[model samples]
Target: MTSNTSAAPRAARRRWATLLALFAILLIGAHLRFLSLITWDEPSSRLHPDERFFTDVASMLHVPASFDEYLDSARNPLNPRNYTKNNWYVYGLLPQTLTQYAAVMLSPQQVLPACVNRPEYSDPSITIGQPCQDTSLADYQRKIVNPDLAVPKLVWLQQALNAEGRDLTGYYEIFKVGRTWSALFDLGSLLLVFLIGLRLYGRRAGLLAALLYACAVLPIQLAHFFTVDAATGFFVLAAVYWAVRCAQNGGVISFGMLGLSIGAAMSCRVTLATLGLLGVLAVAVRLLRRDPLPNGQEDTTDRSHTAISSPRQVVTLSLLLAFAGGLALLSFRLLQPDAFRGTSFIDVLPDERFIENIQRISTFVSGEADSPPQQQWAGRTPFLFPLQNILLWGLGLPLGLAALAAWVVAGWQLIRRGNLAHLLPWAWVTFYFAWQGGQFVTTMRYYSSLYGLLCVLAAWGLVVLAAAKHLPATRVRVPSMVAGRGVAAKHLPATRVRVP
Candidate 1:
């Protein structure tokens, strides 16, 4: 068969391969997340310290539908606080609100506050100073934290709470509902990794990236906890992907999508603003390169097809981007009546809160903050920590080395070409490596968000090696223009070449 004659069949084969790869990766993510979900024994287990923060926020972020419900939550002695932590408000609202709604649907019932009332004192022998009272919920929780707790008082408390017709399983179930969605987010990121690779390279690269991301330990670990990291990571990648797409297309709507994605990521983790910075940088490159909009036309006849080459088109795209960013800022503001007060979102940089946050993070990163015992040793080996964590066991040795090399190579090319679409992957790796490596006191999972991107780079490294061995069989295109000709952006077909 002639080479060009089989192009259609090859493309069809690639599509099928992509579908199969997606199914396999999704299956792996789901299986690992499921194991994590069921591993904790409910009766004797406690949530992670951070998880407690999320569930509480989830509960509070959830407004009561009825007055009675609101009163009950307000009156709870255990609750003891409002959703007023200024620092939390920075990353508040979206994840907590979304999870609260999910939990409300998945777990309709919960134990009443009175069910965990303070214990009364009563001595069995009426002695002057014998320990005689019901334990506090905080202390009681501590007693049961050990999976092997043999304390009869803990068992008695569970039995007592159950006898009151409380929905014993509902609390954990509600908390777990957020984690369930997080697994789905992890899966979504895996899918994006594949698509991004397929967009940039070819089917083999896409499949390889998807497989590596699915098998990576940190992503699997991210799925186990109910926190912003899973959602933030997914959206951060999504923002970068869409930013690339928007730059290539120059569509106003696409640019708006990029902004919303950035907002979503930031809303979950203010720290994720670093990830959004890549998108911003890429978009700036798109403007500086004078990339033409989707509809390229010189005349005022077709405003929609205006090219970025024109000043008016640049202004138009800028306005669209600003509108989207404003909307995102409004969302955060609405979450708290006092958010930003009279100040505009642009004022965040000069705001005291923002400055304080920066200083707080600086102190924490500089080994001045109160860190756990494990983190104390991290100060000794800052740079090597992330290198070992992400690239070594996390990605496997060969894959890790290839990915690291690919990041370096891709970064150099970005410097030379100044291509907007290619910048995010390189920027993502550099930002994380610098941030995480410098911070030192963190787990491998801290770098989990960018694992999908790293896998894409790793897959790309393989493709580059293959291209060298078979030079004539490969082509790369960045999708420059597609006007009246309607030439859509598509990948060059992946081909195999044999060398003598």
Candidate 2:
């Protein structure tokens, strides 16, 4: 009877620990993303410029029925014909359209065409999305802001505000609603980081990794606005998780999940396909090798992962990957017809617009290529991004440098020692770092995806270094303790050393 009672309590304790860890991530990540999103006195969200475009477009989803009106309203409201014609249609359509439709669903069916006050009187562009002076803007308040009618005083104030044209209660509510979704997705990346770290490292390492990502300053900086990068980072992380799974244990379901992750990433931002390519590479390497290496899943941590042993598994996984990719392409074309122009999924890049984007990204990555003043890359040394920005700025130099050293050690161990298990992770960090470092201009936000994985590595390295000690009168120390100037190992060895 006592044992049974103790077992129940233990399970409850485990459940609570998991909940607390997840909630802590949510709190820290959400705060970073939504710093000052709402205030006790403010009526609208104080989001970034990208956020402003999303918020402003809530009024046009019904008036114009095209989500592409965002740029036109802000930059070319007077020239409605040339509004969406510029750069509006060039971005990832799903996120913006989702926000627009969600706003419309929450708002009234019939919203008045946003009136433009010409620049002769006032800059119409500045006052474009504001409530029109002639229309009874108050008439549609009921559909826009859902009132707490059970509270009489609140209902009365809400109704009174709708009467005034200056009261943009509907528009405010619409954007606020949209920002919630963005904030959640951005914060969701943090949640996944915690789980990934815990699975690879340990509980303490996971917590540290989650904190590193939450306060790292890059992800947080971009998380403030609902943008393609933020969404891409989340999907990329998802792909990383599935890739790790495929590496540790190649299975049919893992490939399918990877497909979904890659599809989602590409659908958000085409450039994110780079990570997907790495994922496919990871799968191929896993299949070809007789002794497939574990991808961080074999950590001393508690999770037990699968391994591939049968020929049937390989064939099934391959077919599922193709199925998932096709489904993703079909969905993207159906929803974003304008962007695809009836082109096949593979043909999205050949389109004139994508060619321009290719040139732009090329310019951004390679300093030799001429770029517009606004689109320049910082051209900083690649290593400094993680060492200086992530570890030094956030965690202080002592521990931060140790983390960087750890990453170097791992890479060396993989290359020289032939530690095949880390191939997937090494490829991810290497490709991403090469791309980011080579770029002529980069932002902290540009590093969010790579940053998440490095945080995991750094956290794992920190914890291992902190806990382990050399045995008395030992001739050899742990590789990291002596990994100066450079090197992962002499060869990728399978032997597990007991240094203690």
Candidate 3:
């Protein structure tokens, strides 16, 4: 009774300690991500090409006055298709809309309103030698002290006025705020990695995984940029997390979360629509009754429950999956409404323009288009190129090898013991790598979603190694007494416990 009572407090203390460690890991991750968050115009006029495009696109956007206006497919500013000026609307609408609104809210004064009354101010392309009607922007123009002033200061003010021919004045401010959002998204990935690891292994493994992801070079570098990659990775990990949850629980709420996460992921990158495969696999595992218990325990009796128990059970499962699919459609519509522009409620089809753009992008991505960037991959081997880069730069050598080893170990465990914890991530990792590694554009950012899963696998391996090290193979005999009588010595094996 005393041992049991004391064990509770020990466990409670361990939980508190784990929470503290996780909090520290988050802090470290935040520091790495947010450090020098805005660097687009740093050193020189070094604007990232993608960031410049996003800023320009954001400048052209107009927020709808009401919900009805937002829903109007033809005139909707939220829809990338409505932007008649630019034909290149391939990227997701979420980041563009988010950065646009976020910039306006955070720095309202930075935006120069459309001075339609003043033709000179109306055309942002014309250099403003004098202050405009918008008094907020005028203040910056008024701050020009002398001809010998800093070049960057003059450039910043001039760019703010130009706004690439849009009413929103400060491109720098927009990019800066966008970079902040990117950092936050990457931080979300870090936290999700922790949670996934914790779910699969234990507290120590979770912390280790979080630390590995936080310190990874690629995620940190991506966090410094204002792009969709970080957001895409975050949502993808979130989808994977919820899919794992749905597999374990087999409940309505879990499935709903899984669908929502998958929708959010696809909204960032259409390629992420393939995450539906992971969700389907989870559902299949759940249907087969192969899901592990919440405490990571195997249910020997559940083996017989693999087959459908009754027609009612089948009907219930079907309805739950339908609800999930419906939610996914609704979430995608809300996030990327432009994709549903040309379709009626009953006939859900993506816009023709969106499809065309996707097709065009696919050709470019597949090296069919003789673009300058494609030249770099001219002689590069298909799968091996991405694999080597991911090892060298994405995860670094040690972590890359460790993750690879862990994956092999995980695969072996899955085959031998049917461990779903290993199986879930392996399915995602294998599917994603197969698709991405075979692609022509093998940028490291494309593999950002794999970081969380790989870190979890590596951490699990480390934890397993530690457990094996601490637990002895042979048992020792010890003499014991029962009540008042002496008992014979018996040899008993030491049992493995969960890592704290």
Clashes of each: 1, 17, 0
Q: What's the lDDT for candidate 2?
A: 0.53
Question: CA lDDT of each candidate?
Answer: 0.56, 0.53, 0.68
Off by over 4 Å in 2: 1-16, 38-85, 88-90, 108-178, 288-317, 331-336, 343-351, 354-402, 470-500
The order by descending TM-score is 3, 1, 2
- Give me the runs in candidate 1 sitting further than 4 Å from their true place: 1-13, 40-44, 52-91, 109-171, 288-308, 334-362, 371-378, 417-421, 470-500
How well is each residue in 347-464 modelled by candidate 1, as lDDT tens digits?
3333344345556665765678766744655546777877887777778787789888878766654554332335667777787778777774666666777788899888877765
Best by the TM-score measure: 3
Cα distance off (Å), candidate 3, residue 80: 3.8
Worst 10 residues of 2 by lDDT: 480-489
Cα error, residue 240 of model 3, in Å, equals: 0.9
lDDT of 3 at 211: 99
Could you give me the TM-score of model 3 versus the true structure?
A: 0.80
Model 2, range 1-500, lDDT digits (tens) per residue?
99999999998998789779768877877777788644422654544655566555533433322234232323222221223323333345556555554443343322323332221222343333334344455553212222111112323433443333222224465555555566667687887777667644446667877877787766665655556667777878888777766655546677667777776776676666666565566556555434312431222311123245378856765665676566556555544433432223344443344446556656545665654653443546655654366565544565456556767877876655444445665678788867775555555556667767777777766655554442223232222211221112222122232211
The lDDT of model 3 is 0.68
